[model samples]
Target: MSFIYSISANTVSRRVILSKFFKQKRLYSSKRAIILGIETSCDDTGCAVVDTEGNILGEALHSQHLIHLNNGGIIPPIAQDLHRKNIENVVNAAVKLANLSFNDIDAIATTVKPELPSILFKKFESMYI
Candidate 1:
């Protein structure tokens, strides 16, 4: 199994990273790997479960886009608070949709710095690590 946790807001960089993941997967494991990905970099909190074969087992997203839009723009404190409130539910929903518990997951992937808020990082760490 492999766990990739990092921060990169660039789409091109993300694609490159994912490509490398697939190539390395072949060198590292014989069995398909199940990955649970969590994203709380901004106003939205999201989670997804997927396998190396490009199959999406489950996913959930909690968006605060409209709230931010109403406020004219994103407020970091508000976004952080919403993330705190919603992360657990989003993660559980994704796991439930996947028909698996945390033990069934092979690895966890998340954003750890730069783009992600400190509160979210701590929250996720406390929940999973």
Candidate 2:
């Protein structure tokens, strides 16, 4: 019953999040579950929690735009480090804002795409703290 589109940031300009939770096998009743999403491909760290019905529970995002803008370009190492520094807090805040804890998340989703290297993908897949 919660339908909110929320976000938090330190240096991000804008974000447009639209994705659904990955389907999983269910041996029990057809109850809805939640998915947490993390994005840290380029210059921002974004997190969101959504339900099976695609309602956004809560979200938090941190952008390194000013840093990149000041630096004159997007440096991969700097972007990675910034993601490392802020991902934990961002994820935590999103779950908190949703009035839930990590355990409440039935599934997790993150960015893994063409432009990002394996390292970044690994971070999104393995690192949540």
Candidate 3:
């Protein structure tokens, strides 16, 4: 029942930077681990339960993409409010989709970066805590 939990956007951000910096052909490869992932770096409230095998057991996403696009990019407070509004439901759906629980998760990871507003952590707390 042991699995890893990551709040990391590392998959989406830093890895790309490092890959580009080092001129590495391959930045990373997924391993044999189960991960519960959350993303609120912007407008989308996304959650997923995935195994190291690239199998997504469950996933939920609250997309503000269209909204932002229509509104002409992100409005900070609106983004934060949307994330705060949907984070919990999104994560819960992902977990339920995976048919797993927190006790089954091994670790928790988060996406940390600069220039991004506070939506990430705020959504984090809004989700569970």
TM-score of each: 0.75, 0.71, 0.62
By TM-score, the best candidate is 1
User: Relative to the true structure, how large is the alpha-carbon lDDT of every model?
Assistant: 0.73, 0.67, 0.60
Best by lDDT: 1
Q: Candidate 3, residues 12-122: lDDT per residue as tens digits?
A: 432111111122222453334456666666678787777656788889998999989988999977787777777778888988988988645433444444324245555
Which candidate do you rate higher for TM-score, 1 or 2? 1
Q: Tens digits of per-residue lDDT for model 2 on 8-124? A: 454422222222232333345487778887777678888899988989999999888999999999888887788778878898899999999865776665554424333644554
What range of 10 consecutive residues in model 3 has the weakest lDDT sum? Answer: 14-23
Report the Cα lDDT for residue 84, model 2: 75
Name the better of 1 and 3 by lDDT.
1
Worst 10 residues of 2 by lDDT: 13-22
- Candidate 2 Cα outliers beyond 4 Å, as residue runs: 1-25, 114-129
Q: Write the per-residue lDDT of candidate 1 for residues 1-129, one digit (tens) a residue.
A: 233444367631121123335556667879787778777767788999998799999999999999999999998888878888998999999999999987667667765544445666566657765
